[model samples]
Target: MSNEDFLENEDNLFVQKRVPHDDLHELVKYGDHPIYQGLKDDQSKAWIKKSLFEKLDYQTKLNCVKEEAMVIALERYLIPMISENQETSYNLALIRICTTLTKGWFRQFAIDNYPQLINLDKDLLSIARNVIEKFPIKRKKPVLLTHDPETRVIFDSIRPYTEILSFFDKLEYDPDDFDITGIKITSPVNGNISVTAIITTLCKYNFSCNPSASWSASVIILPSKEMEIFLRNYKSSKYELISDLTTKYIFSLRIKANTSGTSWGVGEDIWKPIYVEAKSADDVASILEIPGLTGDLLFKYVLDFLNPTLARNGETPLKHWVNELKSEGAIPIKPEQHLWYHAWNYELKSLFM
Candidate 1:
């Protein structure tokens, strides 16, 4: 199928529900029938058992739960069972019931708020990568680890860590001492335990914020298994190591005010709090390295970057801007816009070397 066709089908399968009034009422009435009466009557184990069986039978007779209310009831009753049983029928039923009741709420939410959803997905991916790097697994090429098909979704979500490890491992020079080593460690100490350490270091160095920025950097350290173990245990307060190899080539980035002269407001001195002038399309294009940054995207990046500063300075009536860069369409959006607000404030010399 064409991409549009596939998306349309997927949307139909997952979008939110809009039911007819009379049909919805009938479904509610059916759910309230005596046979299914006990489903909502009690909260204990015996009540749950009775409710599950009754709802199942009621749903079976109707060929499905018709009302949104019934769908919710079925979800609460059945999701636990499917999660535990791993039965194909049960899983399918749960998916159907959820999709039916939600009217594809999850899918619609994903579609309507694609940008926000993408950001959240990235955060989840980042967390997953951190978890994998912090907890090393010794699966060699000679032995491929296999998981149950049912758990494939969980596995795929975390597979980025493997790529992250490979990327870090390829960085031969350490950022700390400039020593050449094939291995890249994420922590200053050792092992795969430095998640907390790296985060702590980032914070100690003044780079912690709610939605902190991140970029890649490298550091060299002594090569020893004990050191590895120590680095493994290192945990930073806010910054996290994306990989668990050598401390080189760590991803780090941050957001800061556009403290440049142009952002200042009228009558606002350079020292006074003021809005930074928006970056030209050329400037933003250079920084982002995306040829198609439209005027709007450049405005977004600048505004987003300066959001915290604006809030702090009590800037009012915030305006978002967009500019077109010659003819390259819209500038490519930054994947990690959330992290742009919390920046490291120390001088380059103080933090490195």
Candidate 2:
């Protein structure tokens, strides 16, 4: 197909929008950042050229987070406190800075600053909270943020593809049967630890191949010999498995990779699961772009790839598409984006596209 044909094809309509970082940052007082003066910088430059519905840069969604010196940044957000119900409350000016209320050492700042924390821009809160969890702080009290009650949200926890590769390295299994039972989740450290679950992963090709391709996970029983390191890393370690799983895979919850870098982990407190769900929701459904990946669009995207057409240049369309992504430096941003890289083939896995 010609350039015009490619652009006109419903499958290839990449919606480019005006970059609003300049205004957005200004709105949130991000423009006055001492280190950077202008609204347009290397960061916004990247986003500027990026279309709203552009193909994934393949960076972990965390890469999209606005990173800052944790302590310094935390100091700025203010939370209000109620000292009294009457004139005393108005006179006291009961507002707390995040730093003073948070502990001196590594500890959670959000909880103490919760009333203020809830006010964070929804997307920023997800990336920011997950990043905070990565610090070596005591996370004994993680409070979950609330979601809008209007719509239902789905979630999936993804380990980086490296984790999948490390676990599946030891054994082989039938693609047709793909048994979760026989898949031994033995760790080098915990030779025969019991596992909670062996979940077959779902990788979406359309968004990102790096983490999406890193498929499958076997949760190691905690406090066991295993450190849950993936103990090894890589999806190429599982690419062969992926090539097959791609064809048979089905629906998977939208993935949320904890920035903590833990592959095999023990559960946190009772509220842990809910806190995770909140973060996971932040990662996936946080952003929706029209002319973007809806069920219909994704379906069409898969159909286009499945029914590839020959081109005058002697290339299959899908291969060309993958090549184009590569050409644009859409290489996997390693060091693990989410927890896993997942993959799927079109026959049964088309929905993943």
Candidate 3:
């Protein structure tokens, strides 16, 4: 096709062919449509440019060329006819267009620029909220924010409450608190003996523990007093370690590795250490189900540990052992037997086994 024909064809693709003014489409197709040719003509370019500046000044109160260009492009080309007013259909079309164009940024910008639009018609806010909740944005994690009634007001007002809550949710604590001072046991330590040491340490330090929580690779520290009492109450000889509670609080500690090194060499090497709670031997066994640990072993561990307690009217500590076993490792399973996966799986198996 000729260059003019090609440009016309491309422009036609952008402008809908079937509209109320079908004659306009035919007129444009024949290169005789006044509006179509006017829009396409070099002479009309000046008017188009002027129109954009006018709209930008009217809409945003600014007249910068780059800013005006985007507004002009959207007004003349993208916005549907139905979105020209504040009526129900207009609001809906506006939301649809904003969603199509801006995705996640729509809500924040809409709230900033069009607070009256949301306040005058709550349905628009609701629609926008629903759309934003489902749309994923490029950020640290999948967006989990939901649209509640209260959030509707927050969005309309650009309030600080929601922003403050969002800030706290993303906060990460300093790594030093749990890592450096917490218990550290090297491999080859007797399981039962290690358990005893852990419990004794906790009890002596007064660290409170909950035996029911799953034993996982988490870094949280227990209070010192609760840690001490736990150690005094735990006793088991056969297992690798008889943690008073299966779940332990761990903290990431930074250790200095090299004295003569520069930069991070003399800096801290970080490691997470866990504080464990004691559970029934059966619970412990079920928790320890290290991939190869059979169902029988799982059952035996629960039964043996809880049997004496059960005989003495104590409660069975194990809950949903197999499911816990199945969910033991990191999700979105690793692609290779790398160090991180190996370490993660090893830690998981060790905790449960």
Each candidate: RMSD:
22.0, 22.3, 23.2
lDDT of all the models against the reference? 0.27, 0.25, 0.27
Error of 1 at 15 (Å): 11
Every model's TM-score: 0.18, 0.19, 0.18
Query: How high is the lDDT of residue 248 in model 2?
Result: 28
Question: Which is the leading candidate under TM-score?
Answer: 2
**Candidate 3 — which residues are off by over 4 angstroms?**
1-122, 129-226, 230-353
Supply candidate 2's per-residue lDDT for 257.
Answer: 24
Model 3, 201-244: lDDT tens digits are: 11111111101111222222233245456545555531222232
Q: For candidate 2, what is the lDDT? A: 0.25
282-314, model 2: which lDDT tens digit per residue?
A: 112112221222332222222222222211111
What is residue 240's positional error in candidate 1, in angstroms? 10
Worst 10 contiguous positions by lDDT, candidate 1: 259-268
Task: Please say which candidate is ahead in lDDT: 1 or 2.
Answer: 1
